[model samples]
Target: EEEHTSCEIPRDAIDVCGVQDPDDVSLDNVKEVLDSIKVLFEEDKTIKAYRLWKKLEGLVGQYEEAPQEQELSDKLMNAKELITESMFMLNQVTMEAESVFALLEELDSEEGWELAKDEAGIRTWFKQPEGSPTYHIKIQGTIKSPIFDVLALVNEVDLYQKWIPTCDLSKAVLNISKFKRMIQLCMTPPSPVNWVVSRRELMLYGYGVDMMEDNKMIAMAKSPSPGE
Candidate 1:
């Protein structure tokens, strides 16, 4: 009878049950940290951080069973936590940036708007951008009420229908912070028009900036992007 011999396969050579070789596991935590820091210098840090966090989170799952790399796993987890905190802080920065850009877009020029109506101390201007069926309208008027009072009236979303003749439905959909919220408004057309045209519903992102030192307050509203 020939002597029987047993041979053990090297762990690296085994490919059972989708388990990765210890040598093949590459967390690259340092590279991820560097990439996250690079995102800080780029535009839209909130979005960038979110994407990176998702990527790292996937990696964490992929290497969950990795061998002898507890330190690297801990570092990756720490990195993910840090990115989450950064995301919250970056969200505020993004909101401020959006506000600044919206202000610039609205106040950049008067060249495109054409006078549509002027009566009773109120002026209305309309601008139809190329290729867009809808028109951009601007209404200008002076309110005799104090600035703070006007600000309060605007911030009170539930009472919009009581004050604005055209608005029939107004409500706050989401409150982001003390000074910012998402609002929904429905405008009812005049008698003859209302009979034919459906109510126009608008989803707006609104925020207020108090400039007490300048004795001025600015409240801005615009359509929110899908991501928000």
Candidate 2:
């Protein structure tokens, strides 16, 4: 029998068919984002990968299901004063990438290419910092591949189950202006535990933020109305 690849999954299939294996991914040679970065100055290909990967890793956390009880949500939000933490690690990588790129440019043309990492497992400059809470994360990057197509996936609810692990349903109450969206979501964790959870979210997005990281950055800057 032929191996069942992801492309084989039928449309409207509710369950997430497979989780991407980290080992099968290659982060090196991250798609060199020459348009924006190159315009600013020069940068290494690896550092670009590093910044982008960290940003992507940050999204995995955004996929978390809402808390079970209203009380729990209140307690959690009140305690933390927010639903999620801003991605500091990702910003750090961006700065680091910029630094390395500057270093590479100063060296001879031969040296810049020499300094660039072109290995399979490691990208040109993305680095994993040592520490807690962040070390568990890994960056798997791609460059200019037709594979990402994240833009098309934005409003495609069916595809969420394919990539986001905990999304049961995502109903868009509004999409007028990116910041004005109100979305409802439910929890659907991986099985051995294939049951729905009671918690729901009607969060807003795109306000109180500027465009960042090729537009993958999502900052919730507003609260939705009760009905919205």
Candidate 3:
């Protein structure tokens, strides 16, 4: 006695069977269709497998209870096994894609982002908002140093050129309090795109903002909205 593999007809195969012309339904043709779908699954083409599975699910229903054709019955059982495997792979791929998208969103508040590249201690992530050419960029990192010492060095605008390796000149445009200021910066190897005179917002974690649980400093440079 041969070992019998038991399998149920996939829903897509049933649907395919339902929509076919009544005159066109035949055991040989249905068997051939199932064989084709099994080949796609064996080829590791998940997308194609998913598509064929759907087609098979619709068609399989018509012959599911047809106990007359032994060959057709065997082929249908094999097709079900292949379709089940294909659907599992497709589900895994979808879950992985969603997880990566969530991580990127957590990195940047903006949505519809793709990871361009990352190297060294710096991480850069960008997104084109509203289908525009302009990209919103976010960079995050940590530097090991005495907290106060680093803050003092960063707050001294006039001393920028001395410590900021790439800065040619840094001048305070306006001192808007200890928490906010506007500064003009010129880069050492200046290019038109690298030049920026922007308003800077400084948040001292322990002093005022409730979000910062530790004594950490955050600096944000204001820029125009994307596509401006």
- Say which candidate scores most in lDDT: 1
lDDT agreement with native, every candidate:
0.62, 0.38, 0.51
Q: Compared with the true structure, what per-residue lDDT tens digits does model 1 show for residues 140-165?
A: 88889896797788879999999888
TM-score of each: 0.55, 0.28, 0.36
User: What does the lDDT read for residue 211 in candidate 1?
Assistant: 38
**lDDT against true structure, model 3:** 0.51
Span of ten consecutive residues with least summed lDDT in model 1 = 13-22
Q: Output the TM-score of candidate 1.
A: 0.55
True-structure lDDT of candidate 2: 0.38
For residues 170-195, write the lDDT of model 3, one tens digit per residue. Answer: 77777643544667776644455345
Alpha-carbon runs more than 4 Å astray in model 1: 1-85, 118-121, 211-216
Report the C-alpha lDDT of model 2 over 1-228, residue by residue, as the tens digit. 844322222322212222122222222211222112221212223344454354434433343354446655544344232212322323433554544445435432332122245566553433234563432222234546453365456656445556666766766656644333456566655655555544445454322222244443332323443322
Q: How many pairs of residues collide in model 1?
A: 0
Find the 10 residues in a row with the least total lDDT in model 3: 203-212
